[model samples]
Target chain A: MKLGVLFSGGKDSLFACWQAIQKEEVACLITVVSQNPESYMFHTPNIRLAALQAEAAGFPLVEVETAGEKEEELLDLKRALLAARERYGIEGVVTGAILSVYQAARVQRICRELGLWCFNPLWLADQEAYMEELIGAGFTVVIAGVFSAPFDESWLGREIDRRTLDELRAIAQKYQVTLTGEGGELETFVVDAPFFAQKIAIEEASKVYRNYNGVLRIERAGLVAK
Target chain B: MILVVDLCYRDGSLSRDEFVAPVERILCRAETPFLTRHYTAVGAPDLKSADAAILCGTALMDTGYMEQPELFRWLLSFERPVLGISSGMLALAAAFGGGTEPCCEIGMVDVNVLAPDPLFAGQEVFPAYEVHEHAVRVPGEFVALAASDRCVQAIRHRSLPLYGLLFYPEVRNEWIVERFLGLAARQSP
Candidate 1:
């Protein structure tokens, strides 16, 4: 089946894409860029890099801009899916939703309306196991945003490796936060993946952190040979 | 051990992670032992060994399991506790001469308990995650236990431990699966 992935330049979305590529043809990467930094459904931090990631993975990208209103963002997502179906002839849509019924249901409704099958490969996944698999799968994921306590500016731009995962596991157990950041406690960006033909090398970035809230703003990045 | 039956389009398909793994995680957290097998590969020995069975859901667009109702005929004679979820519910119903109607519900919805059963005991109304394209037309041998405004949300056999839920309990409703497991544990020899 030809499918379009809802890419967010995040680990979950990219991991979902990798899984889809194994079983089906990933026809395109669909991204809905929200102007609202706190968009309910779409991932905000480093979302623009989805195109680069799509290019690295050799998949077509369908990008759409949204004003990020409460319910209006869903319309923009629908527009992106429609565009992907028209351009790439995708039969279904794939999502990276792990535990958010709010996000999953909205996407499911939209896909049903579009007559496209919706598949959330990460739906209700075990968070710790999922994080372990993400690292074990050779995905070089870095912290791009943090929104809760116990995460300081030092965590920004930190690659999620074994040591980081071990620390995250301890923090997750202590702070009662999800290890995979499914609760909007954190955001991640993938610099490399197993399927990537090239790796993303960050040239310049800036960090803005205050009171446990921060973002690793990638000022410049380009694809490099793996 | 609990037999988790994968009802996806094919064994080891992408949908298994979505449908089967979550249930396994729930069982794992509960410290319960479980074994998973695709519906097509389930032999008599599997049914014989399993203390209980949970038939997992599939993607809304995947109906490959429903086409082969004969594969689930064992569900009719097997008196062991069984819980079917979403597409698995359709399979359980089909094995007992139940059909389905076009009733689509995708998202969180309010489910009202219509009949008192241990699966939903003491919970009059609750929210459930539903991702089904059709609703089972409650089989004659089963009684409707709960419902949403749109369609029946749950059903169970009149005498057997067989049960079917049209919602995915693994999502924000792991308690349902836990309750089923508890019920199974009590009924086990």
Candidate 2:
């Protein structure tokens, strides 16, 4: 199937595209950049870097803007999907919606109305196992933001690996949080994944931690040969 | 929070959040705490502490699907306010003597409210996200609450606080979830 992935430059979405490429043809990457920092739907952290990620992966990228108001932002995504369908002849739109029905259901609804297949390759996946699979599949993902207790400022920009997974598991068990950062515990960014022809090199970044929440702002980044 | 069981197939196609995250967001908005478990972890004993239980849908089960025999037995015997979602609705139907027929819905479906029920309060037509290849034919004493052109979309037991919905309530259907939470809270000991 020819498809467009709802890319966020996050581990889950990148992995979703990687997995989809194995079975289907990924035509482009569709990204909805929410102006609302606290957008209820789309991920905001490290979002500007999505274009670079798309370039590294050698897929055309579509960027749409939304005010990110609760239900209204879905329209922006819909517009992006429609454009992808018309421009690239995509038959489906895939997302890395591991566990957010708030996100997945809306995408599915839009795809349905537009006659596009909605594929959530990471839907209902075991969180811990999914994280492991990313590392095993040679995806270098890192923490981009942390929003809750037990995930302090130190977690920002930390690479997710076997040890990190173990620590995350322990914290999750202790705090009853999701191992894969579901429930807004944290957000991730993909530095390198198997599909990337090049890796993202962060030139300058800063960790902004305040009021019990923090994010790693990527000031400058460029794609370098892997 | 309610206990949502992740019933997706384990072949790496789907994740638990396809079930857990949407419901979790709803409950979080309602200030409810939800606990998640794999379908295999849901023994009858675990059901004791939960205020309610939700069976989640799966991608792999779009065709013919069946639960573990013991799990089916336990679900049949479970006496609580339960909400069956998508594939979960099929499990409920099968457990209650109803069965699933092959269906091919995979997008937004408009289900007209046939009767007034707590889950569909004040809503005439509930638009829900559906991704199922089978629709539940509800059993005896379970009234149909809503339907799309294709099949029955919602069902409820006449007496007990048991409900099954082919439509995903976790997606833009907070009323359905809030109402179910209200029923669960009222019924919980």
Top candidate (DockQ): 1
Candidate 1, lDDT over the whole model = 0.93
Task: List, residue by residue over A1-226, the lDDT tens digit for candidate 2.
Answer: 6889998888888998987888779999999999898887885698999999999999999899998988889888889998898899998788888667567667766876787767776765657668878899999998999999977888998999999999999999999899988788889999998989999999999999986699999999988988
lDDT of 1 by residue, A5-56 (tens): 9999999999999999999889999999998987888856888888899899
TM-score of chain B of each: 0.99, 0.89
Which candidate's lDDT is highest?
A: 1
Runs with alpha carbons beyond 4 Å of true place in candidate 1? none
Best by TM-score: 1
- Deviation (Å) of A225 in candidate 2: 2.0
